[model samples]
Target chain A: AQSVTQPDARVTVSEGASLQLRCKYSYSGTPYLFWYVQYPRQGLQLLLKYYSGDPVVQGVNGFEAEFIKSNSSFHLRKASVHWSDSAVYFCAVSAYGNEKITFGAGTKLTIKP
Target chain B: GGIITQTPKFLIGQEGQKLTLKCQQNFNHDTMYWYRQDSGKGLRLIYYSITENDLQKGDLSEGYDASREKKSSFSLTVTSAQKNEMAVFLCASSIGRGTSQNTLYFGAGTRLSVL
Candidate 1:
């Protein structure tokens, strides 16, 4: 079965500091990766996605993710964080030609001033 | 841009009662899904529909029932609300299922509380 894992349950960082959220996936075939962010009491919004080609993919709000096939990981990173960036993040994966996606237990991020 | 809407932003239901949640999407997408979100647990798929009148059971569909009578609307019902049950139910849709173009758009979820 395909699964996604996000090791950290919560992360606290200072404003303007760099941020990195880890994600690991388990799948036999080539996988489609995605990162989503959710604000309090709001629906989730897509941050980035990786299907194929270059490992590095840029997303909205200065966020980016790199897919490492060998390590089965797609980690999200931001050079500088803002207080508004504090939210819950989720990593998801789906197999080629499959519409079903598996999501990781989200990581709650807190940006301290 | 299209939007997805879910009715009853917050629901308070009695135990053993049947509760229904409605979702509507103007994206004209062919696939729609229902998921339950719980604290400490990621979203769990309850049901999905590939087209109007098509229903597919997901991993956590035992106590739930779903209807997709129209292309733009999908509804989920809790067969029997459990006491102390508290969770958010999310509705999502995508263009279609294929190699590409499967990005899902979600609606603000409905928070359910069972008393």
Candidate 2:
């Protein structure tokens, strides 16, 4: 079974500061990782996804995630964040043969002015 | 660019009542999915259809039934609404079954509240 773990339930950061939201997964097979973001009263939108190429994948709004197989992690990063970037971010994992995509508990980001 | 629409943006039901949520996609995707989202818990897959009339149960299929009568539509039914239950139901679709086309496009979501 593929499972995603987002250790941070909530993160508070000042605007224009660097950010990193941690994510770890447990999957025996080749993993397909994704980052999805949900704003208030909206559906989740895909931020980025990783399958096999470069370990680091860039996403929308200057967001990126690095897939570390040895650590079983795919951590989302941003050089600087804006107040508009505050939202609930979820990390998900799936495999080639698996029909189910498992999501993490989600990390609610709050940007301070 | 395509859109996924979920009917009845908000639903209020009484305990023990049966509720149905409808979803339609214009992307002509081959797969559709139903997921439930709670406050603290993340999204949980309830059911999915790989093609028209094909239903696959997920880890949280208990007390729920799903139907995919057409390639562009999928519906989910709650067997019984629990009292004071509140959650958001999300509908999503993908192009195909392969890893290359696995990106899911989601609807705005339907919020459900039970009294």
Candidate 3:
């Protein structure tokens, strides 16, 4: 079985500061990682996904994540954050032939002004 | 671009009552999914359908029933609403069999409150 772990339950970052949210997964097979964001009262939207090729994948709104197979991690990063970035972010994992995806508990990000 | 719509944005039910939620997608995707989201728990898959009339149980399908009568619509039913079962139910669809590369598009979600 595959599982995702997000170390931080909540994170507060000052606007214009760099940010990083940690995520780790346990999967024996090749892992396809994804980052999803959910705004208040809205459905989750795909931020980025990684399957092959580049280790660093860029997503919408200047978000990016790096897939580190050696560490079994896919951490989301952003050079800067805005107040509008306050939302919950989830890290998910899936395999190439798997039917379902496993999601982390999620990290609630609060951008402080 | 397509959209997934989930009817009854909010539902309030009494304990032991049966509740149903509906989902519709215009993406013409081959797969549709239902997931339950709790406050701290990320998202748990309840049911999914590969095609019309095809139902598959997911990790959290024990207390739920699902029907996919048409390619564009899927519905979920709670056999018995638990008093503490206050959560959000989400509907999503993908272009294929939910492979590694297929992106899942989601609906806004239906919030359920069991009193």
User: In model 2, how large is the Cα lDDT of residue B115?
Assistant: 96
Quick one: ranking by DockQ, best first? Answer: 3, 2, 1
The number of the candidate with the highest DockQ is 3
Note the DockQ of each predicted structure: 0.60, 0.63, 0.67
Clashing pairs in 1: none
Native contacts matched by each model:
0.42, 0.51, 0.63
Give the Cα error of residue A112 in candidate 1, in Å. 1.1
iRMS values in order, in angstroms?
Answer: 1.5, 1.7, 1.6
lDDT of 1 by residue, B1-115 (tens): 9999999899999999999999999999998999899988878889988889999887789999999999999999999999999999999998875653378899999999999
Between which residue pairs do clashes occur in model 2? none
lDDT of 2 by residue, A1-113 (tens): 77888999999999999999999999997899999999987779999999988999999999999999999999999999999999999999888866678889899999999
In DockQ, how does model 3 score against the reference complex?
0.67
lDDT of 3 by residue, A5-24 (tens): 99999999999999999999
Clashes found in each candidate (C-alpha, N, C closer than 3 A) = 0, 0, 0
In lDDT terms, how accurate is model 1? 0.92
* Interface RMSD, prediction 3: 1.6
lDDT of 3 by residue, B1-115 (tens): 8999999899999999999999999999988899999988889889988889998788899999999999999999999999977999999988766575678899999999999
